[model samples]
Target: MSVTVREVATPEPGRGEVRVRVHGSSVNKGDRLVMMGTPYVMRLALGLRAPKHFGLGQDVAGVVSAVGDGVTRWQVGEAVFGELTLGAAWAEEVVAQADQLARAPKNVPLAEAGSLPVAALTAWQAVVEEGRVEAGDRIVVNGGSGSVGSYVVQLAKARGAHVTAVVRAHHADRAQALGADAIVDAELEDFSATDARYDVCIDVAGSVPMSRGLRAVKQKGTYVVVGGPTDDPWLRPLLRPLGWMLRGAFSSRRVAVFVARPTPERFAELAAWVEAGRITPLFDSRCTLDELPQALAELESGRRRGKVLVEVHHRV
Candidate 1:
């Protein structure tokens, strides 16, 4: 059931689970896809008529208020962050598997912490997990102004690599502010036509053609697709990943799709990076809780610079 600011039953921590009083939930590209049901395949599991979990939010950062009987490593009132299994985040309370919860970085605000789980994890899986992008590797993050794309830019830079940000002309300046060594305005410059090459090319924009993305990378370079329309019969949510894997096998050039699940270890890594100031999660705009409906509309319109955060409580 979905509700807000009412006496909804507070979720209780089940065995191996914990309940969190959420402070903020950040909207992301996946959340946008799940909300729209565009590819005609997402509803097979997420529910056809209306989603199982009525709440829409996903990336959560808040304080643990209760714990399940078997969970001992965590205590009540500790700041924490993670992804929920379904769509229970927009609501005031959420119950998560205990093993997935992670302590928030000591120096980061809960609101900013909420932005990292999904977006950053996808970037991590792409650069670190699939691409094996090491120090000095050249990475190009297409659509660098969006949530995941923003993190990819910062994280790639943090890895001691050369980073180029590709975004629409309007966001070019903002991308540079986030430490992009250079910016490519997709509107003016056809990044596909450029002869320059990168070791790893991450595409979050989805509008860019797969062939064009592949061309921007050098021989044996990695091309990662995070979201978009896909051609798949099963696991619609994973179509992009599956397609990349299949095509990559036949081609000499590397192509991979990135899908990441939130885990305590990965969340911890995100929190640490943010707290240490090595990675800065560019917040496009901080919206109030009541502004969620409007924010979703704007987000779906496809013009945002960074993470669109719904901050429930100001940093205290």
Candidate 2:
């Protein structure tokens, strides 16, 4: 898969949609998957040979430049941020359905706000909704240094859960700053081999065996798969979770896999968290519209920490 920036006709908003002058957009796992057209299993919905959509950013923050008919919640020039289920967010401007966006966090810059959307929502749902993490619960967040992992750590801490952040050794201090009660070096320690039993195990790294993750959970505990396997993707990324679910069905453990559902209301909830200072997005680097290809290449390298933000159009 290759990326090339091409100038296309600037799109106009349709019914219930708004045209946004994108000030900041961020690269994410979904962008990489869409660009590669991998896990061919998803092609049924994405595309067969190539992506069904041309553009490739999912999280966007910008100003509403135009609003279509029947739209009342937003006005032209309102700053907003949200996720686009369809790719097309990588451009200078993008058209987003009015229902899928919320006002950008007033407490932070639009570049930081652009880093939320998918990762924040995914972490919230996994930690609060599916995992049922609560006060005094012992929770282990596997892969605690990434975009989603960092959020999981903070959200879990806000809920008063005792969090153990499992990550690479060098990121130990970073995870601790995110409120980890304990840090486990995945490079040197096998989390499953530890004596620590957690009430909830969030496997975002997806590097370890599913059985190992399941074993990390305490008896009658929950195991949530928020990311995919690290194996080369043809179908492994899609199939590993299914296999885990099937295994879970026959056991007493409560295991579930989910994809984050984006909505305006969800973004509003995240915005509130931001305003309260409970959530802070982490950034690994910054890029511009013309550097999208290079940014994506860095993302593909798996060396990035936190989110890689793309500056699309600077709003005054």
Candidate 3:
């Protein structure tokens, strides 16, 4: 798929919406999925022939430039960050529902904060909501050095759970720095083949077999699927999640395919965590708006270490 930056009319906020002057946005796996229109099943909602939305961004951080009627929670100049339910955050200005946004972290640059919403929220749901992680729980996070996995390691640690991060040898130190108690170098060993069992197994890499992940979990434990192989254009990514759902019916272990639902409350809590220093955004690299196509390619190349940020407005 080809992408190019084009000029368009600035949008106005409708009722209960606000227009933001976007400072930052980032490339996410979801953006790539949407751009590729993959898993084929997703195309049912995205579009049958082509994507309904041409813009390819979801995370946004910026200052509110205008507000619509009935919106009172935010003012014209409040710094905010949130997920756009639809794509289009790649542009200079975006109009979003006021309820979907939360105040941007004061300690971080808005560009960096833009990388947090989707990745952090996905981790939040996996560890807190789906996994129900608690103190003393043993958890293994596959792909722990990636965007979502990085946050998963930190959040699980904050909950006092013992975290084992599965990453490439090059990223082992990076994962360790994020508070992982142990590191499984994917280049050298298979974590699933070990005798150790975990209270929760969060699979963000999706490179390992589902059966392996299922076997790694303790009885009645949870296996949360955050990502999967995107090589097959048909249903490779969805297959593992669907298999997990089917396995969940009879298995003692709880299997869940994690899909992030971004809400104002969740965003607020994430912001609070950022402010409190419980979690921080991890950036792999950055590019300007004009270079987003290359950034997306880099993200798709599976070579990036963390979030690849797109500096739209570049505010401090």
Candidate 4:
């Protein structure tokens, strides 16, 4: 995928909208997929031949510089962080609906908060909403070393669940450090074939087949698909996760595949947790806005852990 930076007219917020001076942003898997315009299915919404949006970043944290008419929830100079579905967060300034953003906690760094919106929201949706991870439950998070997986592990632990993080051997210690009760080296153990059934099984990597996830879950347990499906594009836009949903519909197990909905309520909840020291967003590397392409390249390399951040405007 080809990416470049350009100077564009600063967007004017419409009614009930707010314009923010983006201080920090992060690259995500959605950004990579949208930029690649791959699997041909995503093109229907992203672009047929090329990307519709010029801006690439989606996770944004910044100060509200201006507010449009009908906006009463936020005022100029309020710090906020949220996801922009239309994608242009890499720029110096971005416009978003007032309802789409939540006030960033004063205790959290704006740059760190920028990395929390998308990944944390996705984890919240999957682990809490879909998985329904409760205290004393045995939960396994595949790809527990990944961006979303890290959140899932932590959130589950926060809820008092016994979390077993499945990751490469190299990330085992980090997973444990993130609050996982047990660390399973995926390279050394076949999680799918293991006889250890769980109360909930969260597939963050999408590396395993539906049957394996089903097998990993107990008879009445939940199996949640967090990330977009992996494999050929001809299957669907988000891919094989749809098939998992279909399979779960007929099974006795509570299987669910859902896309994360990033709203102010969820963002506020996460912000509160961050302020309380319950959830901490991790970053692999920090870069300037001009180095976004390089940051994304590093993301594609699969060597980095957690989120990669871009510091657009340094806080004074």
For model 3, residues 38-136, the per-residue Cα lDDT tens digits are 878998999998877767789999999999999999999999999998879999999999999999999889888999988899999999999999999
TM-score of 4: 0.95
Error of 4 at 259 (Å): 0.5
| TM-scores, each model vs. reference | 0.89, 0.95, 0.94, 0.95
lDDT of each: 0.76, 0.86, 0.89, 0.85
At residue 154, give the lDDT of candidate 3: 96
Model 2, 1-316: lDDT tens digits are 6799888988899999999998887877777777877677778888886677677889989999999999999999899999998868888889999999999999988877888888889999999899999999999999988889989999999889999999998889989999899999998999988788899999888886866677788889999999986446687887888988897897778997888898888889999999999989777788888887876776677565457888875435
Candidate 1 on 1-316: residue-level lDDT in tens? Answer: 2224433677788999888888878887667667766455667777788766566778888888899989997899899888886756775778888788788877767777788778888878877777777899988887888777777888888888898888988788878877899898888887767899889888777666655667788998888877664333356545555766787887767887656877888878877887889886557788877777777766656564357887875333
Candidate 4 residues lying further than 4 Å off, grouped into runs, are 228-239, 301-306, 314-316
Candidate number with the higher lDDT (3 or 4): 3
What tens digits encode model 4's per-residue C-alpha lDDT throughout 1-316? 6677777888999999999999888878787777777667768888786777577778999999999999999999999999998888988999999999999977878877888888999999998899888999999999998778888999999999999999999888889899898888888888889899999999898877666678888999998988655445565545477788789988889988888999999999999998888899777779898887766766667655457888886434
Q: How many steric clashes between backbone atoms does each model show?
A: 0, 0, 0, 0
Q: What would you estimate as the lDDT of candidate 4?
A: 0.85
lDDT of residue 43 for candidate 3: 88
lDDT of 2: 0.86
Q: What is residue 25's positional error in candidate 4, in angstroms?
A: 1.2
Q: After superposition, how far is residue 44 of candidate 2 from its true place, in Å?
A: 4.0
